[model samples]
Target chain A: MSPSRRHSDPQPTLATVAERAGVSRQTVSNALNNPELLREDTLAKVRAVIAELGYTPNRAARQLRTRSSHMIGLRFEEAQEGTSNATMDRFVHTLVEATARTGHHIVLFAGDPDDPLDGYDELLRATAVDAFVITDTYAGTPAADLLSRVGAPYVTFGRPWDDPSARHPWVDVAGAHGARLATEHLLEVGHARVAWLGWEAASRIGEDRRAGWEAAMAAAGTSTDGLGVRITDNVDAARMAAHELLEDPTVTAFACASDTLGIGVLHALAERGLRPGVDVGVVGFDDSLGAQVTWPGLTSVRQPLEQVAIEIVDLLHTVLSHKTVTEPARMLEPTLVVRRSTLRDSAR
Target chain B: MSPSRRHSDPQPTLATVAERAGVSRQTVSNALNNPELLREDTLAKVRAVIAELGYTPNRAARQLRTRSSHMIGLRFEEAQEGTSNATMDRFVHTLVEATARTGHHIVLFAGDPDDPLDGYDELLRATAVDAFVITDTYAGTPAADLLSRVGAPYVTFGRPWDDPSARHPWVDVAGAHGARLATEHLLEVGHARVAWLGWEAASRIGEDRRAGWEAAMAAAGTSTDGLGVRITDNVDAARMAAHELLEDPTVTAFACASDTLGIGVLHALAERGLRPGVDVGVVGFDDSLGAQVTWPGLTSVRQPLEQVAIEIVDLLHTVLSHKTVTEPARMLEPTLVVRRSTLRDSAR
Candidate 1:
C-alpha cells in the first residue's frame, strides 16, 4: 500500500472499543474513569480492545471542551535599582517546590517599570496564564487597580494599604506582632533604654514595625520623644546610624527591623570598640541566612516562609479550581530565635 | 452587519496596498519592515489604506510556508539538594536579560520523570520551540541521550564527559587555567607545601582543577606524593581534614575547590588559635556571595557568570535563526580576587 493510503486506515474510537467489548458506552466510560468499580474481566476486555484498535484519548479535544490550561503565572517585580531582598528569593524557591507537587508549572514574568500609574497592565495583557501570584507590594502600586481591571484570580503576599475589607485572599506574617515580640524581649531583660534601628519609613512593613515599637514603649509608660530611632535606606546607612547611636552610652540595646540591618549594627559596634551582647544587646527581625553567619549569631524573629508559600499555592489552586476558600486572610505568628547577640552576661 | 458577513468583506491585502501606493512588493515590505526608509507622505498613505481595510498578516500561514517559531526552550536537570548557588542564580538572571533584548522569551522546563530512559521525549514530540539551551550537565545524564537522539540544535552551560567529540556548542570558564593561577599565587607568596581540599573527583571540572594543582606543584620542584588531598561529601569532613593538615607544620597553605569548603577551613583553623593569614594561607574557587561575607573575607577566583549567560543565549539564537556561529565552543578566563584570607598580614 502507498504511504498515504496506509496512513488513512480507520482508527477505533471510544465507542468502537465499547461496542467490541460487549458493554454499554456508560460502562466503558466508567471503566476508564473509575476502574475500581468495574469487574476485572470487563476492564481487561475493554483495555484489550482499546490496545488492539489503537484508540487513544484526544487530550487536545478534552482541553478544548474544558478551558483549563493548568498553568499559573508568577509575576516577580525586580528591585527598582538594587538587588532583590533575600526573603523574595526564598519565597520563589518555596513556591517552585509547592507547585511541583500538584503537577503544575509556573511561568515567570517581570512587571512593568516602577510607575505610579501604568502598573502591571503591560504584563497582564501580554501573558495568558490562568492565575497570578504577586509578591512584595509597595505603597501607591497599581497592582490592586490592575487586578480589579483584569478580574483574574490572584493572591498577594502582603496586604494592600487601601483595601482593608479582605476582598482578596492574602497571606502575611504579623509584622507588628513580630516587632513587638522583639522589643518586649529586650525590655523584659532589664534594659530600660532601648533604641530602634530599622529601614526607611516608606515601606508598609517598616511603618508597621515602627508602630509596634512605639506601642510597646507607650505600654511601658515611657516617653516616645528622643527614643533613639535611626532609619536609613539600606544596610550601609544602618551601619552609619549604628555608629552614631553608639556614641550615646544611655542607649543600651537596639531592636533592628531586619537581619541585614542587624549585621551592619554588629560591624559598626565592633568598629567603635564596643562588643555586642556585652556592652549593648541587639535584636533583629527576619531570621535569614545572614542570621547564622554573623559574628555573634543574630537573635531575631523567624517568619515562616515555607508555610506562607504552601498556603499561597493552596489558595491560588482553590480559586482557580472554583473551590471555596474558608479564610480570606491568614496571618502567621513569628517566633523568636535566641542567639549570642542578645544573651546577657549574667544569663550566660 | 453579522460577524460572518463582516468576515466576508474584501479586505485590501499588502499586495493591493503596494499597488495603490505605486510601490513594489519589496518596497512595501521594507516600508513595514524598515519604516525609516520610506518618506513621510508615502508611508502615511500606505498605513492609511492598510488600517482602513483592516488588513492583518496571517502569521500562522507565513509560518507554514517558512518553519519558524521564534521561541526557545531552556531545560534544567533537577536542582542539587542545598541552598541555591550564587553563580547559577546570577547566570539565569543574565540569560533572562540577554534573551529579552532579542524579542524572544525562554520557556523553562524540567526533564520528564515517568520515562527516565527517554526524559526529553515528551518535549521532543511536541515541537513548540525552535531551539533549546541545557544547563548543568553530568555523566550518563538523560539530557545527553536526549540531545543525541533528537539531533536538535542546542547549547550547554558545561561540557559533556561521555562524548568529548559530541561537537555541541557550549560556553564555560577555563577551570584548569584558574586552578593553575591559584596554585602559582600560593607558591609565589612563599608557601612551599600546599594541600588540595575538594569534593567528588568524578566531576570533569574537579578532575581538571586537580590536574592543574599537581602540575603547579611538580613544576615548583615539590613532591606531589606527600601532598594532603582530602575528598569529602560535606563541609564537616573538610573541616576535619583541615585540622589534620594543620598538625604538620610543613603544610603552610591550602587550596580549596569551592568557597564553601574554604570557609570550613577558616573555621577549622580558628578553633586551633591559628588565624587564616598569620599562621597559614587559604585560597578558594568561585567567588560566591559567601566568600565576601566571611570574616577577613575569602580570597578566590571569580568566574564571568554574566558573560557566559549572554553567550549561551546568543549562540541559541544564532542556531535557531540559521545564522552562522563564528565559534562553536567558547572558553572564558577567570580573574583572581585577593582578600584577607590569603594575605600574609592584616596590614596588607
Candidate 2:
C-alpha cells in the first residue's frame, strides 16, 4: 500500500515517468517545471512519456519542495443563515472564475458568525492553502489581525476604512462614486427632494454610499435636511420605512443603497398606487439579477465583479510569489445601469 | 526557507510539541489523530503543549504519509455566466458547512460548460481531492465516466436515469412526487385543467417533474390530453409560450418545472391582468429564494437542499471511509409550500 497506490497497481510517479522516458529524475522535473531549460527534442520526449504514464505532478510532493500549497482560501459569510443574498453569490462566482483561470483552486471555509474569523485558524492549521481572499470587511474584522499574526499572505475585497494606515493588500469598489452617479442621475431627471434609503447597519461601504448621496445633494445646492434617510435591511422593513418617508409629497425619488432596498421602495410605491419612473423615480445599487426582474426593472449601479475578482486574485498571487504590488488598496469604479425604474413617464 | 516557515520563524512541529510536553512524537500524533487512545490527562497535556507552541499539523506531510488529500471536489457548473442560481449557492453553502464539521473541506472546480468535465483530469492530477460531489447531471455527463475511469469515488445529486444498471452512489429529490404534490394541491383548489411549464432541455429531473404532473392528472380520472405542456428554459420565451398556452380558457392552473418558468408564467398572467391564485393558480418547483420575492409570492415545491447537501457529503464520506451507504440511490421527498399565488383571490 504505497502512498499513491489505488488498489493493486501503484499510481505513476516522476520516477516512473523518468524511467519510462529513459531520462533522469531531474530531467523529468525540468520538463514539467522548467521546460525552457531542456532541448526541444528532450522536452517533447519527456512530455509524451509523462502522458503515456498518466503522470500527475504530485502537489503534495511539490508543496514539500516549493513550500507553496497553491490553494487559495475564501470565507463564505452569510449575514443571515439559510437566506439567499445575490451579491455574495455573484462575488463567489466571479472569484471562482478568476482563480480557475490561474492554476490555483479555491478552498472555501465557513465563516463563524460569532467569531467572524471562525474557520481561519482551522483552515490555516489543517490545510495547505497558500493564501486567503477575505471579503465582507467591517470594523474590527478579526481576520486581518489573525492572518497578519500568522504572516499569511492575503488580500481583501473591502477597503480597511477602520484602519486607514493598514498596509495590507485590498481592493474595493468605488461605491460612493456609484451612489453619486445614482443621486445625480435622479436629480438630472427633474427630481427634487430625493430620499436616500440605506442599511441600518454601520458599515464602511454603507457610509461611503451615503456620503456620495450627501455630496451630490450638497453640490446641487439642495437642503440635505429631512432627505428621508431611512435605514432597513429587510425588504418589508424598507418598504414600511419608505411609506413613512413618502409622507412628504415633495420627496419624488429614492436613491437606495441596494437592489433589495430598491425593491422595497418599489413595493411601497405600488402600495400607494404610484408608478416607478413616472410618478416616483427609484435607483438601486449592485445591479443584481433581481434588478432586471423587478416589475419596472430597477436602475442600478453595477459592481465590476469580474475586474474586482481579477484584482483580488492577482494581488494575492503577487504576494504569494514574493512580488511587491505597489497599489495595496486598488479602488475600481462602478457603472450605472439606467432602466425603466428611473426614467420619467416610462411605460410599464 | 523551510516548507512551513513564516518570515523568519519556523512553524512548530509534532517534535516541538512532543519535546515541550515531555512525551514521544507518537504521543503528539495520538493526541491529534488518535486522541481516544491516549489517557485523558496525557491527551490534555499534549494538546495544551501543542497549542502553546502554536503547532499545526502539516497536511502535506500527512498527505505523503496517509495518501489522503482530505478534500471533496465539487464542480460549479454555470448554465450561463453571471446568471445567479440560488439552489446551487445553497447547495454549496450546506456542503461547506457539512464538510467543515467533519474536518473535510471542499475544493471547487469551475465546471466547463463546453465539455462538462473539462477540469476533471486537471483536478484529479493536480490535487489530492478524495472524491467528487457531482451535480447538474444531464443524459450524458462526462464527469461520471471521467471519474470512474480514474478510479475516483463520486456521489451524484441527480439520479442516474440514463443507466438504471449504473451502481454508483447517488441521491436525488423525488421531483415527480413534488410535481404530484403541486398538481394535487392545484386540483384541490378547484383547478380542473392544469398546464405544465417545463424546460426544453432534456434532463432527468425535468422529465420527473413533468411525469409527476402527468401521473397526478391521470390518477384523477381526467384526460391529460392537450394539457398544454409548453417547454422553454428562457423567461421571455416561456412568457411568449405561456401567452399561447393561456389562449385556451380551459387552462385554469400551471405547474412549472422551475421557479424561472413560473416567474415567466406570472409575468404573462400579469400582462393579461389575470391575478394568480384568483383567475389562475400557479405553482413552481425548487422553491428558490425568487419564489418568495415574486409578486403575490409563488407557491413552490421546496427541494430539500440542506438535507440533500448533507446526504451528498455523508455518502461521499462513507464511500471514502470504506463504509457502505445502504440505499445509495436515495430518493428524498420534496415539500410544497403554499403561498398567496395559489390562494384564490388572495391579496398582497
Q: What RMSD value applies to candidate 2?
A: 3.4
Error of 1 at A104 (Å): 3.1
i-RMSD of all predictions: 8.2, 3.9
Residues B16-83, model 1: lDDT tens digits: 77787778766677667688998898888877766554454432333323444344566533323222
Q: How accurate is candidate 1 locally (lDDT)?
A: 0.66
Question: What lDDT tens digits, residue by residue, belong to model 2 across residues B122-235?
Answer: 667765687888886865556886777667889998887787777889888999999999999999999999888886547667887889999999998888887746575656
Give the CAPRI rating of model 1: incorrect
lDDT of 1 by residue, A204-282 (tens): 7888887887788778877656664656545556678887876777777788888767766776765565666767778
lDDT of 2 by residue, A1-348 (tens): 012334335678889989999999999999988999999999999999877766788888887677778889988765342222466777877788889887888898786677776777766765479889888686655788778877888999888888877899999999999999999999999998889988755767777899899999999999878884657566777688789988889999999888878878887886687878998999999886667655657899999988999999989888988888887889999999998888886544
TM-score of chain A of each: 0.79, 0.94
